[model samples]
Target: MKRPIILLMGTMIFGILLSVLISVLFYGKNEVSNSIDAGTKKIVQKEDKDPYEKVDKTSPTISVYNSSTNKIEEMDIETFLYGVLSAEMSSDFSEEALKAQAVAARTYIIYKKENNMTKGHKGADICTDSNHCQAYFSYNELKKNKGEDWIKESYPKIKKAVDDTKGHILTYDEKAILPLYFSTSSGKTENCEEVFSSQYPYLKSVSSPYEEQSPRYYTETKISKYKFVNALNKSYSNISLSVDNLINQINVLERTNAGSVKTIQIGDKKLSGRNIRTLFGLNSSNFDIGFENDTVVFKVKGYGHGVGMSQWGAEGMAQKNYKYYDILCHYYTGIEIKDIY
Candidate 1:
């Protein structure tokens, strides 16, 4: 009876061993998987931390002179930025590009305010006239121009871009620089002295390889020789112009490093390229003139002043997956992006 008892104990021990093996085979994998998942979760949480979490969400208030209404409207800087971004950049552009514009626009306004550059805007910090300051449009104007569907679909995207980089501005040497930006470039940006006559180290000429998508990248404006001469004579009242000898008389006196016309001579009057561009309604200072029959063809390259950031080039970089900071750094050399609030 004792021998039988021993054999029974041994049989029970074997069954227990078999049960342990099965449990190990099935349950061990799930334990290891759970351990790996927990490790991955920790890494993802750390990586997804917001860098600007401590920044104040409350934007500073600014007085904006609405040129159309001719009234001073006091609103938060972000609210002002909405109108500026809507008028300055197209909503169809990449989010990164829009973010870049927001930062530049903010920097520009801050620079103006800090330096007391409010001489032109009466008591306001800035004006909405695109010719004077930056272009701007109210929400109602946007709805009128872009329609209700666009406001519902695309307007929120612009607001999001502005919010993502709130209170952020570009700076050089810890001071806000005059962050000038333009619509397009003539293959490269111009130096500060070349265009604005004031030299800023950060606003150096840089190669802009991505503005081919701009509609104004290459534009040809055809004007009658008679009209062209009259326009030039209107600006320089003493200059004599003959339509027959217009091409021969017109000579590019100087060109900037980026190939923009620095100084151009038409007849006896020497005019800066910026003056000629404004006087003749040319899209950019970088232009070539030629006669096609009785018409004078002005082949303009790019648009705007061709200084600081190139908006179309920023969009091109954004298309290649560049971030907003990357676009700003590429255009405005040696600048730091920091919170102004």
Candidate 2:
């Protein structure tokens, strides 16, 4: 009986050991699985921590003030550029000239945005008024202006020019430049100091012999001698006008380096040529006065302020096979083309 009892005790001990071994194996497998799951969860949490890790850096949007509607509109930069290009430059220009205009327009706005110079406009980065900011023509307006077929043909070309030179801007010394462009020039572009209060090294005088292609290169407007004197007196209240004083006394007192009249002596008062141009509705400051019969003839040369890039000159250069960058560099003077994106 004692031997049978001892054998029974040994069998019970073996059963207990087998049960403990099974529990240990099961626990070890479950621990390995839990560790793998925890590691995967940690990796996922890490990835989710940075929300902007895969955000797109390009295609930024801007806020514009629609002067016509008197409302603020938000749109993508590229879309805004389409309107600007359409209104600012004619689609008939060469692709390279259009591209150069695109870069210049982009640089101008970016510079304005960077400087926070919105001219007191509320809740907007820029405006649609071309005189104030940059000119903008909506797709519908462009269709109306050019017709459906012309829009279909020309819009793609304009889009190509804009897209091919995407994010390109002019930079002087690694900073954005305030690129001022105009319709045409006399034989040369004027220095910044000559036109505006501030002087810019890049805005120095440069010969633009190619601008003769512009329709406004040579224009003449005739006004009666009495009307001319009255208009001058209206602008400059100090000026005393009469037929005898106006005959030989009215002459250009000073001229800019580019040959645009800088100052004019009318009767006893001396006025800026720009003032005279504005008073008489002249095309440009470059003008010569003559008395023909009963009319005072004013022969004007070029158009606009003639302070920077000449659009007609740009088109002429493009016709001569100059690339967009080449045209920009020639006009801007010691500048670099940079991709902001």
Candidate 3:
């Protein structure tokens, strides 16, 4: 009887141990699997020599790559990230919450290219808003979620990623955007399956935000020749640079009203959107049609989506001597900042 009891007990112990081992193995696999999705998993599970881990041998070049008197000047990843942070933290963000906006922006930009896209460099092309590919706009209006630590850590992780990409971001000359990816309120970036996905929490009352909504006006002013080159690379005749042609371009943009319509009405002539942007300098998302009083009555606030990486906020932090990592930490949360370069 004693021998039989001992054998049964031993069997039970072995079974329990086997179960625990299986559970541990599964837990680790899940941890890694949870990091990315089916597609992203493939990207993460590649050989070290994977050029995608560093820089791709293939990358698209700028349109004006050949027709250039000056070599395309590359910007530092730090500078780009700094710009993103500074813009996102603008104080004019009265319509939306600032912190969440910054996080979403960082999330979008940082996670857009995982494993190694962007040659390990992260950034987006020149856009008034950070909505080219990475991270769409967001508004955390449903309920104020609590994840301060998570929120705080986003910035640093992003900074570390940018640091890793510094060598690449500083060298790639074309419109080297930080191939970041993002999602609308869809729980995923692929499709906006629901109405309240938070991508456009700004449009609370409206569904399918295809409606045209923005103020429009015109103005006339002369801008420096170099200014036009930096702002928009309109094919300028290597032969001649006419300021009037610049004005005409603005008129065309305003008439189309595709992205923006900033025109200057000088006497009887109307300037173009590009021209007015160049002249009046439409730096932020919204522009001033005209000043109302002591206050600039222009529709504006929180640079970018009001969703991520506030440039003004960053500048404010930088003024306080906040290290880049510290600044990133303040915005993002729950992510380890690994220098994979």
Q: How many pairs collide in each candidate, listed in order? A: 0, 0, 47
By lDDT, the better pick of 2 and 3 is 2
The true-versus-predicted C-alpha distance at residue 255 of model 3, in Å, is: 17
Is candidate 1 or 2 superior in lDDT? 1
TM-score for each predicted model, relative to the true structure: 0.81, 0.82, 0.27
**lDDT, candidate 1, 113-158, per-residue tens:** 8887887687899999888889998989999999999999999999
RMSD of 2: 21.8
* Model 3 C-alpha lDDT per residue in residues 1-341, reported as the tens digit of each score: 99999999999999999999999876644413211222211112211121223533432221111111222234432444433533444333221223223333433443433323332122322222333332111112111331455336443443443343333321112222222221111111111112113432111111111112111122223344455434333433232333343433322323221122334343234554344443445432223343222222323221222222333443334443333443333332222232222
The reply for model 2, stretches above 4 Å from the true place, is 1-57
lDDT of 2: 0.80
Writing each residue's lDDT as its tens digit, candidate 2 over 271-340 gives 8889888878888998999888778999999999988788998897777666677677777777788887
Q: What lDDT score goes with residue 255 in model 3?
A: 23
True-vs-predicted CA distance for residue 110, candidate 1, Å: 1.4
Best by TM-score: 2
